[model samples]
Target: MQLFPKTTTFTLFCAFLTLIHAYDVVREYSGVSFFDEWDFFGSWDNLTLGDVYWLDKSDAFSQGLAYVNSVGNAIIKVDNMHSVQSPQKRNSVRITTKDSYAVGSLWIFDLVHIPYGCSVWPAVWSLGGSTWPEGGEIDIMEAINLMPSNQMALHTTSGCFHNYTPPNQLGATLVTDCSTAAGCTVGELQPNSYGSGFAAMGGGVFATQFDVAGIFTWFWSRPNIPSSVTQSNSTSGIDISQWGPPSASYLAAGQCNITEFFTPQQLILDITLCGNWAGLPEVYFPSCGNRGPTGICYNDNVVGDGSNYNDAYFEIPYVRAYTTGGVAPTPTATPFEIVSKVDISTYPGYGSVTIPLSAVTATNTKLQPSQMFFPGNGASQRISWLQIGVGWWMTSIGVIILIELL
Candidate 1:
């Protein structure tokens, strides 16, 4: 009798700690919802992509350049016909999420396709609230020309750097010191990680987990994503614990303070051509060396010649934000008991289920819910007795005796 009471007290204590550590989905954007969550940013100019065309809020929709497709997917596309003829100018789209994500948040993006072409530079990045480098920038996806893989970069004030050993060697760290001048960069080594190869494989999902430990990113090919992600209709109920090791882990122990370096940031997705990174004579000329006399020139060959831009577009399925230790919505259900036996074997399997304990007064659906045991917590926690009733003392002992027989 004492053993049962002791175990119950211990389990409740563990559950309370677990609940405090878990991340909860606070906001989710998918399909048509994505368009509503983001706004077209047209005030800036891209000197890198040359004197090009950027569609404003009104022009992007009215001109048929950017909008939600028939199936409710967000589409940001470029004009191939106009781009080819006007060598000096090419039309493109840039948009930013309306809300900013704070420190210690996880962002997940499901993409069906990404922009890829000879003169194109497309990116999905996050910017801090402060000016350029002071606030920090996390480039989730950035590619130039026909690059084989994506490049993830961090642009920050002078002090920040990539000090952590990567969990795996999937990407090569191009730079370590994260300064505005060069910025720290890591290039994906996987062949089909970006550009045409990524589109050929049908695009994929990218996740960024930003917390105090450091920033981490993971990518999954279309076919290999977790079932929870593919089947998740809402951000709630999707757990990141099920996902294995991340491809890129940037924890520097105590060397870098992420909170100090990064501020609240807005997400961005855009495509531009033949400027800065891609348009550099050294970068573009080498990629298009085979184009000979007619192929390499900026205005005539790359954009003016109207290089095919049929693939210069992004097809986004969803983008969501989950935060650990964030405010949870008011839970409706009050505490109730629904206990079942937990396995005692060395190989733990505490057959636990989440079922509502009905009551006339309960307004919320979830009722005193808790996991029997979290895997990897420990083996000693898997043994317990069944207890279900109006009060623990009134019916638990009877149910425990009956459960032992059945």
Candidate 2:
């Protein structure tokens, strides 16, 4: 009786502590949200105090967003004027450093986006601090008009670029694999034949979890996924530690990954059209705020020096995070269900059940029957449609459990 009570008692106490720590941990994960909602400019030092942070754009604030001017190609004096509606919307900053992290443990980024368009180059990505090709860079979502498709990539000296095709296209492609000295790339489409249509349905969330194991995975859902809703959806971890460091990256390792160097990573919401990446040709701007994408658009002598960086940008509703000692619910263990459904109503199966397979795969991981999925009996009247998807199992053994798909 005491053991049960004792454990319950201890668990309750831990629960209380978790409640108190939840906000703090949550703050670490939601660094970008806090930065957006609050005025954290110039108070960089104060931000470090509570893990809540914001950037100081030594200029004016506009449309409840930050706007900075070109100090020249790379450097710019930032302002709080967030202009640009859609077309690669959002601006971003880093939080990790070479010294320490904001939480000193693990972190999860739950990103929500508006939608996509041509002139839009919206994305959620990360750059390593230590050394180029060594520290690492993660491209979460990058889609433009030229390539109106979603892609996730890992950039490191240790690994090549691994990307995901929009949806429906399958088979991983890579001439070589990424290593400390080399890297590789892989891509595929989604299972459903939907062309980013669900994204417009709103509440699309893409999550990335960086861990100690050489594994870092990526996941996406039209809406926020309940912990582990689908095992087949989680991306395979890409090992990048072997690269040593990525000093050549935009942000040095000390500033890129070390929390001590920067606040929780800053969230960017921009939709720039035809700049460096999209191959937008040069324009002869008669003056500031007068430039437009390609072809010749009439230019007029604009008034203010403000609209200097006129480009596309996206819109977001909310951004939150989860870390140790925070106010949010401690992230529960999300169970993943790799659903390999076979419409036996059309084709019977005691053999391999052919489901619509179009997720990303790599060279090391073969796309050929990587594993046979046996749904047993998909249409059992008494069994219902409940036990009809792929179940979980130890990598060494076979799978166990059958979940109903309806």
Candidate 3:
């Protein structure tokens, strides 16, 4: 006998399809509450060998290296007041999201300012793994010294390449190989995409969408931001397709398998001085000329009085993460309360402790931390099917299989 009347079976099938179609896209991170969602990178040893020291939570806020401005914006900055002798790194701030995100999501950064100055290397990027190049690094927004425009890049293992270009991309592809050292880089064509020019335009929004199809990045100045993005909040969702042409695009259709090369990425924001990239003579001399008394990146900009770093601070209003298929839980205003610290001393350079999810007391909020990769840890965080927003589709498939057996 049939499992049920034909009409009943048809109704069940339709309900399953409806559930699959009812996925709601929502913001995973909201503006102004960024400090509550992110954590201070406690490592003092600069991984990039930058001429700066990374501050822990207590020191960052106590020293005023990181704090929320009176205007309700988050400010993570370098010490622009104190002078230090040679061989000593300046105090700086580096922070990352407590949660790591896999693909199939869009990340939007709304900013009023970005760190800049000679010897300054600031980036708003994402890292997939702890090991360099293997986990993949997405440079959503990065530039060195007094760069006139922004640079976007993807640093991955061998085999990934940017052979195909998306239509109407505004940036120029500077590199084709998506390998470690020379990551596939794209230079933004807009002069106002970085530095003083960007700040003059009242800063803007930089959006990066990682999907099965490709990785795309777009930039919109304050006055030109799309209504769809500006109006989106934690409860509401954003429509990236309606945002128009992206500034940069890296297609993964044939050239690379994004799923294989990219891991669950954690968002990172930091400003380092005279690092490997910014300190190189080839990079520093061309733009900044011979600077300071010693005519060196570290001696000139990083040493002596920190007068050169007046602009070296990130003033962000909010950063939002959106994913399709699942309804976003409403975020509570409850501040992140650290109940305990996890000693991650085993991880080299990350000898300090961090507030893990289990240490958080807020159980009713969605802003709680997720599985993450501690500093220097090489293991990749696996993304589950539910995290991919395919739970409904999986249920639908199970129903079909059950009906076949019946």
Candidate 4:
């Protein structure tokens, strides 16, 4: 017969800790649900965009710039009514999430199309405060005019900059100092990475992970998306660890203190016309100069020359946030003691017991998760059983002593 039946039972107990450890989907925004979760910004236009035909905030639905479509997708588009002769302000939409998120979370964006064209500036970025870059801004995706590649940027107060290392998987670093008004940027080199090129390639996925280490962003254009990310639902496991190399990585290990520079930020999606970046005649003409009259493109030409606003929009499939189960803390060090060397030769009878000094010292022990298992259905009951199991082991240790004595 086994000396300790309880000990054997405890050792074989199996625990299914799927819920407590797995990353939970904190929030999901899509279709009509997306409209409900996000708040429409109806205030006067602010980005200093000279060419935009700002729509009335009160008549957003009537203007056809913001609404849920018959297919149940959240539709935010620009008005096609404006033309060069009329030069009427074209209707556009801007919206932000009602909720905010902090560091140590993963954000995923599945887009069907994003804005592109002359004098068109579209962006999906995150911000913390109204006083500009003080609270910091993370420009997840932003571009001006018909740029081929996606641009990712970070804007913050002085002293925050990138600690660049070789082999950046996404794009080349354009600016390292984040405090500049223009912000630090990393530009992607792929032809199909952004704008019309992105649409032609069947859109894609953009994911960002934020933690103590820093922030990392990844892109998977349609067919190339990982199954784990694409197939994940409420119950299915979504392991960020398996997503592979990131396109852009900002490490706070040496230079930036992420927590100090960033704060609880809300997601913003908007498309503006001929604002600060795209307004300059000299800068705007390079990409779209040939298209405009007399080989010239200007801010007013966006509306005056009459470019169709239909293509200047964003079609997002969904946006999701996952609460990361952070790295577990290191276990406490095992108890131990140090003893002075014993002069056994000085002892009379005890001199024969020549035990090595190291042997008597306590062995450092590390308790692995597998060592303790509670075979129960619910968490509360399992916890109760765990306490009982621990008590049983203590009893088993005592019984072992008793057996030795006998």
Candidate 5:
């Protein structure tokens, strides 16, 4: 039975405080990171203990349309022709240091849906909790509107840079031949012929794994295999070790690309309105009155603070942290008092208790989406989660607590 070890009640009951340094509250701060806005204040308000994740979106930009039940595999629908003062202000849910992230941690952001067009910019990036880029920024997903699928990249100083390209620019198309690459326009990367079969199956899955070693690997999956990506890269399949530059599988095999660049980084998620990437010369430039002879995307569909942009949001099923086991290192005592030890003292222990999701709020209001209970020694008796601590949140607590992102 896995009891949190007990000491015989023979000597003095000295009390040591368990380093309860972790506080679970997801919210945005007032400061802005390098590549974006300042007026917007993003946050994770309703958060619970378990895999507490829900979607927060703005219907104003999306025309109030949502992608669910796999219809059209269209999770996002942004208008490239639209222009805005701050791309960062449009539809961005910031995942900041307040969310508990740091070096030696991994963050996995999974997305599946429409990933291209003009002026549409979707990204998963990070900023330093203390400094700006010096704290490090990792961009897991940065797909300029127009490409069929997505692009993986990193942003850091020269001394700390971490970036990767899809095996080929045809990243998502390699899994599904959705790109009409042949009909590609001026700034757009893929042919107009492609939309990746996002409609056929459910949306696809895009994930990033940041390791303690400071390596970041990004990959994607579509409803069907994308021919566009395969045409761009050398390998294609359910297993995409040969796909990204620093493939996680490749690293397992003793090779590296991501680790070579940035060793430690924070993961961020944001959908900007119009900025560097979305406002590229070849991209949303046409709508800005910068047109070529043919005049495609030159109509200027959007003017100021564009309306009716696609509502792109993420439905996170779970976020977990794990470690590949190694030799046992020297054990340090965890300072947690035995308020009431788990009743493992009984072989077939007492039954478990269920905690109300609402009862576990730590100011963020994140409810419990999943449950965790440990039954000891095949014991009949069990215990559900027990509350060890509670309190209002502090700003300093946002740092130091490592968010286990995998």
Candidate 6:
């Protein structure tokens, strides 16, 4: 009278557990099809006030600002051929992913080169809300003016602070408050993590895991990329438990509420010439040397012939997004308008403002597989209890049916 035999029940339970643990490919933006997954930002420079004009899709391809190279890598570069006079911005490209990703996901960026040079500010980051820092912003890979290493940061509303740091993190914590202007930042301690040194090392992989527990970022040079990531494809799902310690770790246990502060994040990639962060005299002069007679970031580095930007381009192999069998909400592509007022007094020496973009619609939509499952070992085992509870419920229902028949 039993509904299922012991062996059958055990096998079913195991299958369910496998589904929960598996990391399936949600999206793969790579090769020639890379441009199809993203939308080019066409408006004028408003947010960062970078001295560069963002190109549309047609213009980007026509002018060769964005294209697929011979080796199948996606090349998104600043204009190195054109000379720009004063009062005109240089030509560059900024792209945002059509799809947005929430928590319980992993993002892997495989690259061959990263933009770097004097007055060249490049970022591979994500923005959640239309309003700045309210939804949240995750700076996965960002630096300016020939920086030696990359900086990972988290920008959120007030009250969120990094109370705990993962023991295995390889980066140095520069800021602890996850505030709007100067978000909690972690600087990579590894050599050749950014700029010319990173390109010379044959580029590498930057993987970010967003879970309920917290956010984690890992960096691997080309030669040292783990087999779990390098060997992973769309078919064979990746297991984060196999990957070792991350380069940067932001734990959300007691401090930040991952679901509240963070939303479905849209991936963004851009090269801005001397905006707020890189344009400041205090920021540019120290790292990039004195500004000479021009005495300004735009005049010193952004003007004249575009030879300085030859190194300012991104040579990416692919960008992959993975989820653990969770159904995320369908995202609407909302166009945001930048606010005209600029506040330069907030960041002190950094010369950056807060809340430059107006608020778009905010949603509290939740995705499944939403537990804190990361670092693979302890966290993975912790999530098994949920599976066990489900298995027990099924067994109990089977016994009740058998008893009723008897």
The most accurate candidate by lDDT is 6
- TM-score result, candidate 6: 0.78
Q: How far is candidate 6 from the true structure (C-alpha RMSD, Å)?
A: 10.8
Against the correct fold, how does model 1 do in TM-score?
0.73
Per-model TM-score on C-alpha atoms:
0.73, 0.41, 0.76, 0.72, 0.41, 0.78
**Mind giving the per-residue lDDT tens digits that candidate 5 earns over 1-406?**
3122234211111211122221121212211121121112223222211111122444322443223333322232333333545212233343332233323333433344433334444554554333322333344445443434333333333333212222322222111110111111111122221124332344443434444333434343443233433332112112223233322211211222333433333344444433433443444453333422333331332234345344334333222222111111111222223232222212110111111223322333221111111111233113211221111132223221221110
- Give one digit per residue, the lDDT tens place, for model 3 in 253-336: 788788889877878898888776777776676666567666578877888889889999999888877554432211112222
Per-residue error (Å), model 6, residue 24: 0.6
Q: lDDT at 336 for candidate 4?
A: 21
- Better structure of 2 and 6 per lDDT: 6
Q: Regarding TM-score, does 4 or 6 come out ahead? A: 6
Looking at model 5, residue 186 earns an lDDT score of 13
Best candidate according to TM-score: 6
Q: In what order do the candidates fall by TM-score, top score first?
A: 6, 3, 1, 4, 5, 2
lDDT of 1 at 75: 86
lDDT of 5 at 223: 32
Residue-level lDDT tens digits of model 1 in 1-406: 3434555655654544344334656577776666776667563333233334667768888877787888877788877655355435667787777667766577888888898867677888887752455567788887776676677877777688775555453456666777644467666655566776688788899888777677777677787688867876654645565565565556645555788888767788888776556655666665654554655535534444454678888988778876654222211222222122111221111111101112112222111222212111245123212211222443354455444433
* Local error of candidate 2 at residue 147 (angstroms): 3.6
Model 2 Cα shift for residue 103 (angstroms): 10
Q: Compare candidates 2 and 4 on lDDT and give the better one.
A: 4
What order do you get sorting by lDDT, best first?
Answer: 6, 3, 1, 4, 5, 2
Which segments of candidate 5 are over 4 A away from where they belong?
Answer: 1-92, 102-104, 114-116, 161-201, 212-214, 222-266, 286-308, 311-406
Off by over 4 Å in 4: 1-22, 48-50, 53-58, 84-88, 166-168, 234-237, 294-300, 304-307, 328-406
Give Cα distance to truth, residue 206, candidate 3, Å. Answer: 0.4
Each model's Cα RMSD: 16.5, 18.8, 12.6, 20.7, 20.9, 10.8
Which prediction has more favorable lDDT, 1 or 5? 1
Evaluate all candidate structures by whole-model CA lDDT and list the values in order: 0.61, 0.28, 0.70, 0.61, 0.30, 0.74
lDDT of 3: 0.70
